[model samples]
Target chain A: MSTTGTAWTPERRARAALTFICEPGRPDLSRFVAEQGAPDVVEALLASSGTAAWSRRARCLDLDALIARAEALGARLVVPGDDEWPAPLAELDRIEPVGGMCGAPLALWVAGRRRLDEILRPGYGALAIVGARACTRYGQALATDLASRLAGQFPVISGGAYGIDIAAHRGALAAGAPTVAVMAGGLDEWYPKGNTRVFEQILDEWAVVSELPPGMRPTRPGFLARNRLIAALSAGVLVVEAAMRSGAVNTAHWAGALGRIVMAVPGPVTSGMSETPHRLIRDHEAELVAGPADVRALLCAPGEQLEGPWMTPTRPLDGLDPRLLAVREALPGRGSLTVDQLASRARCTSAACDGALVELELLGLVEQDESGRWRLRRPR
Target chain B: MSTTGTAWTPERRARAALTFICEPGRPDLSRFVAEQGAPDVVEALLASSGTAAWSRRARCLDLDALIARAEALGARLVVPGDDEWPAPLAELDRIEPVGGMCGAPLALWVAGRRRLDEILRPGYGALAIVGARACTRYGQALATDLASRLAGQFPVISGGAYGIDIAAHRGALAAGAPTVAVMAGGLDEWYPKGNTRVFEQILDEWAVVSELPPGMRPTRPGFLARNRLIAALSAGVLVVEAAMRSGAVNTAHWAGALGRIVMAVPGPVTSGMSETPHRLIRDHEAELVAGPADVRALLCAPGEQLEGPWMTPTRPLDGLDPRLLAVREALPGRGSLTVDQLASRARCTSAACDGALVELELLGLVEQDESGRWRLRRPR
Candidate 1:
């Protein structure tokens, strides 16, 4: 299984083993591995290390069994040199540490039909939508609607949790677009167990990835470390709803550290679930996004006009010349106005008003009756 | 009556008559009045001008009747040099015009018990809360609550309209604070008679102001002109809810142009009323505020610390050393750990972990069991 031609190499084997030994995003270990190469670092650690946590985890060797378990689950190990490895994840090593966590994953256990790198490539980026597990219905509906509208263009990414995360993934699925889940623990078992159905559907159409090897349960530090991956793997992160102390805010922190576009959806200030998002927006840590069009305006490539109608819905009288617009607004809602009366109300000279009236007439926005009094063509 | 103390001077009478002649916010007339004193400009228009709107209205002047009606309504005219005139209104002359309307009012008809200058003086500011007349319950509740909370510190200002305006004024009155209503028309009769009760209460306890004199009705242009006064009188303007084309957005624009702090309260994205607030926040035209505390932070004098408990609620272990925080987070919720075990999970050296545990013990955050394992002092 560790042979050539689609099989794991020595470097891949060492990286896979490292995931089981050292915790994800350990700066010291990652730096050491980067300097000395993974296989050499693994060799040195396994040879002379005593009671150190990495050595202890390494002494009990079950590399073959771990690989077999992953294979049984139809999961594959993707290391740094793999063609399917995401390019954006490389940014994690360059960004400053966040919450005592940093560094890209040594290896990822990927379980899915879709290619991880394709959907997340530059110019065609991914959006991560995250929020509270006990979000309000407003949050849930907004998350779903925003994801559904944007996922067709930008693949949605999120943790496969109960509330906002699952809603985002479901929204993407509803749009017939593949979504990605970056998990904190092993790919063999879904963490919550309640989301097994959604997890299964994701595996059928998209991808679920973890930095931890098979048989490892999630830890508090693991979730924080996993957030860095979520931030690094996407072009932008949109926080829908979150409490002050939540994984979603931590994810936004990571996204900010990685220089990813951080956006937040505004909800009722009365809702506790919206506290973090509102705080982020108020503090200038995140851009306030109202809907999918706003999300696209920030995430889409420059010169790309992908915004939806909600961005700036044109009223019937939009785009009119200022003089014409003023003349139209000056016209009475229920009664007709003579040219002089309209000119005075609009603060325009008679010549300017006459010019505006002719243009307004050409646009079919206003009409003059036989008595020469002007009113709206379609009065409200 | 026109010659004694608190009586109208030639300049004051000229300004009073001009209010009934030219429309409010007419740049040309306001500039003419500013360049040539009001008394001289009024004489010129009333003497020789013909067929021009100002001259036409000037020729039909019933100055005594207008003055008598204002006196009957208990409304007094305040002009530029008056002691009670707001200094902020002077900025209107320098700002670029909006909607073809600009310039300070020739005179303001103020009806209230409270002195406008005292409440709106520098270092002690007023807040303008405006929104759509057809607002949601969420908007209504937020407007009322925000106004109530902020009005005590800063007098609330708003339009005397049906929905958010009336709600905001009522909130201020409920808090036993004065609120000012900047109306589009005469202060003699409330535009929306449905709000007559609230308007009467305001006139009794606070103020109802307008650039238009008594007997003048509000027109489409008059409302646009009125929004400028709401912006000019406040230190900050907070848009609670508004459609894209509503007066609240226009007030926010005036606030920006006047170099005043512009703020907006966020609500549900599904609401049309929240659209303008969200758009303003998204475009960086306004800051997103959750409630009163945020409004105060932006509006309060420099170096003032008026933030509330909701600003940043401190948790029990918030100020702990990073090593101790990391160690605390690493400990399992249901179990205890040895120093070495904790160090490994916390990604800290064993010596560092031992130091952190000692400090954690001193803070009563963690303790050692009989078997010498560390656990939380108040375990969840």
Candidate 2:
């Protein structure tokens, strides 16, 4: 266990202890974690339980040792104070001390090409794609499309799992966008071994991360626990395809809890793989996203469209020209005001008003009847 | 043409006119209708623009004549004010009027053994089954399963088209929940003609509704328009199977807009037809639904738990001792309290406090740790 970096401090011990108790209740882990962070209690538990064997197990999996394992591989340990820390993650601690799969990472072990702080800064597009381990072609294709296109635009975050998640990572990697895989087990072992090549490829070009210490084996619960971190770290979560009961649904729940946008793609009626995402949308728990435009709405920074859709330059009022702003302002109420009435009120000669009206009409502020009566056009 | 009862009055004409304007861009037609109601407007438009004479080519079809045609077959027109109007349709007035492939109907014409309105109510359990006109065997099978079994609980709403929709209708008819075929054309011309027998069977026992007038052919647009009414009039919309751009996608979209629950049965990843619903879920636009339980959530009246998952009831509190109350009061503000700490504040014997705390824990108000700590639980 002696690889690199400093030894585990008492505070670091508490973080490891807290996460162990964070498991679905020995009926009281939350209270204990709340009173004193889990790591703090782990120190006490080992001392008070008076079990020498248990204390040895705890010391064997020390945070410093865990950090050193990654450090030996040229990785950096990012605690809450690091500039690279994601602010959205810290928000998770306020609720239930640490909750769901989306909890703030106690410490992140990063060995990658892209910098975490760079992506976290405004303007870098990052999306998380997660779904059923068993997915339909629809899910795979969409996951690939999103990952490829989004990675070209921004980095993509996801768990290094199978099916939809794997496709998302592969898609982004192929498109040359930075991709990150958050694992449930230690980086030493990529679960499903088949994805090891992809996991390696991602680490070579981007980053592959894990909250767990080295040598820890994967379990069903650990995978469930991994979903929250996936949701918490991304700007939004896109469920590719999943069973109604899949962990992707858990990711969606975590995203919603974090106030992060949750989006799901739809599938054909016959695909069992699409159930999880469909359930979220049908319940109004998530938005129906058909394309990247929908995801853009959920994002924080602006893209493209600078002048905005509504803003227009003011026209000259002095001109006798009807194609200017004078005719538009001359209209009485927002309701259907007739053009002829506007001309009369604006004191513009009928011919001038008519010309101005056409220009205003081009600007989309007024409309006319089939019979040629003029009226104010309501903005859509 | 003989209707059950109608000589014509201002109110009936107003109701019919209201239905007409509910369609997109038809709001302009509202003023003309309001200025003259139905019969008078029809007569006025005819005289003023020679609207009827120009329509001899058949594009500007008369809606009243559509009603008159249904009446000739012993069917009556049902409007929002009608006793047979489906109440679920009330949602149409709230949203920004959904349109296209799945647009809502303005007036429904019915010739049926079962009342349309009674069959669509949530408590009665109506499920909408729709999909691509061309469907895979998997889709067809799921449609049948949904229609056949869920029919025992409620009526199945579907477009009386080919493939998946037809299969669902057949399943419901076989199950005896009383199915309704929302058509794209009038009852006189079954359009697809291949479905003529099923159309006729439904005419005698169920309903076939369309916003399109009688004698007017079912155009592609007409089919798109008819899909929405199917969505709005049902407790939930279920897409058994669909391609990326299939008609079932339209039905799902309408369901989302109407705020009615939209569910899609899952299928295999290999099928291309699974794309749309899978996309719906991935995009967070629809729910992944399986069997009757998923449908039941949509049909569940506000507060009644109907079958399966998330239906656990509150634990009861029949007995509470004072020591437990004191300990509960001593718990930290959104904080975790230990068992030993709780005992110190209770002003009672540690044994009594521990006993009281255990009962409180079982009742779910307070939770404790494996390390013998206790704390308040969040309300959720």
* Model 1 lDDT tens row, A194-308: 9889888988888899999878898999989988998888889999999988999999999999999999998989889989999999999999998876887798665464422
Candidate 1 Cα RMSD (Å): 13.7
Instruction: Give me the runs in candidate 1 sitting further than 4 Å from their true place.
Output: A1-5, A305-380, B1-5, B305-380
Docking class of 1: medium
Report the TM-score of chain B alone for all candidates: 0.78, 0.69
Writing each residue's lDDT as its tens digit, candidate 1 over B308-343 gives: 211222255533456678998998887799999999
lDDT of 1 at B217: 92
User: Candidate 2: how many backbone clashes?
Assistant: 57
In candidate 1, position A30 carries an lDDT of 65
Give stretches of model 2 more than 4 Å off.
Answer: A1-71, A97-104, A119-125, A134-141, A190-192, A213-225, A244-246, A268-272, A290-293, A300-380, B1-143, B157-159, B163-165, B181-188, B203-292, B303-380
How much lDDT does each candidate structure score? 0.84, 0.66
Compute the interface RMSD for each candidate structure: 0.6, 5.3
